[model samples]
Target: MTTELTDAELLDAFHRQIRLSGREDEPAPGIVRDTDGPVARRYPQEPGTSYCMIESPRGLGDDPDHWIRRQVDFFTGRGEEVEWKTYSYDEPADLTERLARAGFVAEDREALLLGEVEGLIHDVELPPGVQLRQVDSDHDLGRVDELMRTIWGPGRDDGALTREMRADPEALDVVVVEESPEGPVLCAAWLRYSPGTDFASMWGGSTLPQWRRKGLYRATVAYRAQLARDRGFRFMRLDTTPDSRPILTRLGLRHVADTTPYVLDARRGA
Candidate 1:
């Protein structure tokens, strides 16, 4: 039953599975579309907080400002940091304005990409001395996290690469590219799958500062795509920074939408 889907169908499929999929398999329950519109909040809240919006806002309601306030109050009341994500294609195109006006600082804007997984090119070789492989060991996790600390500096914590991933291996397929078996880590990337959907989203695809301009990043993308394809996933989605967006675009992925994170850090607001 290999039914091919149109671009609109792929975009719709993305929303149906992701925007509706309970925050990528976290214990979080159904989509939150109550007074605040559809969102999926993180549980066991920390000092700072962020949640994903489950749907577009065009027709979500007549007044996005009012809706955004409610959403902000929901997070602020609990003293959690808030990151209200907005998409370029979201309804009420001015949702970005509403988010900014609500006192949420705009973070990086990225291209949302979707690609079919079948026959993706993964045979590309790494640089002469590098090797790529899948790993889930604590050693690898620590090494990669340390690299993140270096790149992002000592202050950047591990929210995205949290202990949850180590606690739940079935939820992640991580791939790291190393300059050598025992050498310093060059780069690492990971992918996560939704249990009952055609989508698997890639995350944390970053290279060390000096490792850019090489083919390792592209190889990592192909590696993850083929891994998902082999596991029966039909489509691959990734939110990319400008550096990777062009590469992903060249790989035949569709530029479906763009998302910017609007953050309300509890620490700063205090």
Candidate 2:
């Protein structure tokens, strides 16, 4: 039997395999460029959307603030809105505060959770009449949009999501659990297979308010974990809220770190 990796081992592997690998590969519909500080990414199709992935803020040296401004100016000069993602273990300790001081607004903090695909692989019995299936068609993707809006309200856009799905269908798997084959969607989630790595990341996993407390959320997780395992992926990662932390912990995922997105909308000035 393959030995299950310890939490420390898994965390180290995450940085080595996912974070470092991301720097080299350009994700579909996006561009990844390594800067002196963080790795910068811009989604050309998304207009003003960009991201800065800081693997280690310690490397920012004594004048981290100067480096931050450089990144802000680099993107904002082009009228782009950027998000700087800060992890709990990242250095200078006050990275989030520094970003805020640099005009970035802090978003909700989420637990960076990871799990072994083999350990998370299992059959989660869905409530009778509920079905879990993968969706690819634009028509079915519209259903995903409707479900997301119903749960998260308006202002959340999935245009980039659907566009990416259409651009590279094999890179992503979108799944939804429904009340029945013809029923409304109860829960929806997706798995992104990171190129050149053994890791697959999970996103979404939102359930309707009425569907909470049931196994719908867990069912979606299990469904995607199985898919990852079948595809030879060894690990599954997710950024989840504290509310779902306990539930995911019970499902064999470990709390690896905490992450918060500090966003700067340059068009709004600042």
Candidate 3:
């Protein structure tokens, strides 16, 4: 069993390489690491996101103000949303300041956690009545989406989800909890595999208030981690909300860094 990466190694490898790796889903054109910043570029079709800009790094274009507008204009010109994935350890420490000055709003802060799947790969036991299964049909998709919608509320779109599920059902494995295999879904979560990197990222790990602490979420994590391991991924990563920090930490995932997403509306800027 492989051990997880240290903070420094994870940051360096993840930002410089794996973060830009094609998950084998979309074209390589979607992600570009330019002199200004690493961007997940999806013009007209989707919003573009920027990541990891070295502040005041000598050489390629160091004018922060001008460079900031250039980035803002690139997206605003396309009427796309701008998300800057900022880390606490990022250099030019004022990168967040610059982002805020550029009119980007900061989203929730989360601790990035990484773990090897070795110890967590066992079959996790949910309460006797609960069972878990991989979502395989539109009916399952709808049920899982509805469960998430109820927990997360309105404003979140299932369009991207639907498209992803249709495009590559295997890469994004969504697992749901139900009373029976075909019963109403009580909770749901997903595991996304990135073949280019040895890491799998966990998303939508939520449960209904009624379903809390019955080990459902943990089971979901175990199931997904084992799935990733079975598929050959060496590590699992997730941005843990403060509420989820304790549970994941106890499970042995190391806290690497704090990540805050800064968003700027291109439409508003235009």
The 0-to-1 C-alpha lDDT of every candidate, in the order given, reads: 0.71, 0.76, 0.70
Sorting all predicted structures by TM-score, with the top scorer first, yields 2, 1, 3
Cα TM-score of candidate 3: 0.82
lDDT of residue 134 for candidate 3: 87
Give TM-scores for every candidate, taking all chains together and pairing residue i with residue i. Answer: 0.85, 0.88, 0.82
Tell me, by lDDT, which candidate is best. 2
**lDDT, residue 235, candidate 3:** 75
In angstroms, give how far residue 45 of model 1 lies from its true place: 2.7
Model 3 residue 230 lDDT score: 89
User: Per-residue lDDT of 9-85 in model 2, one digit per residue for the tens?
Assistant: 98888877866555323365664455565434443444545343334433467787888888778667767676777
Count of backbone clashes for each model?
3, 0, 0
- Residue 136's lDDT within candidate 2 is 86
Could you tell me the TM-score of candidate 2? 0.88
Which residues of candidate 1, in runs, are more than 4 Å off? 1-4, 23-37, 49-59, 159-162, 268-270
lDDT of 3 at 225: 87
Residue 40, model 3, lDDT: 37
Error of 2 at 105 (Å): 2.1
Candidate 2, which ten residues in sequence have the lowest lDDT sum?
50-59
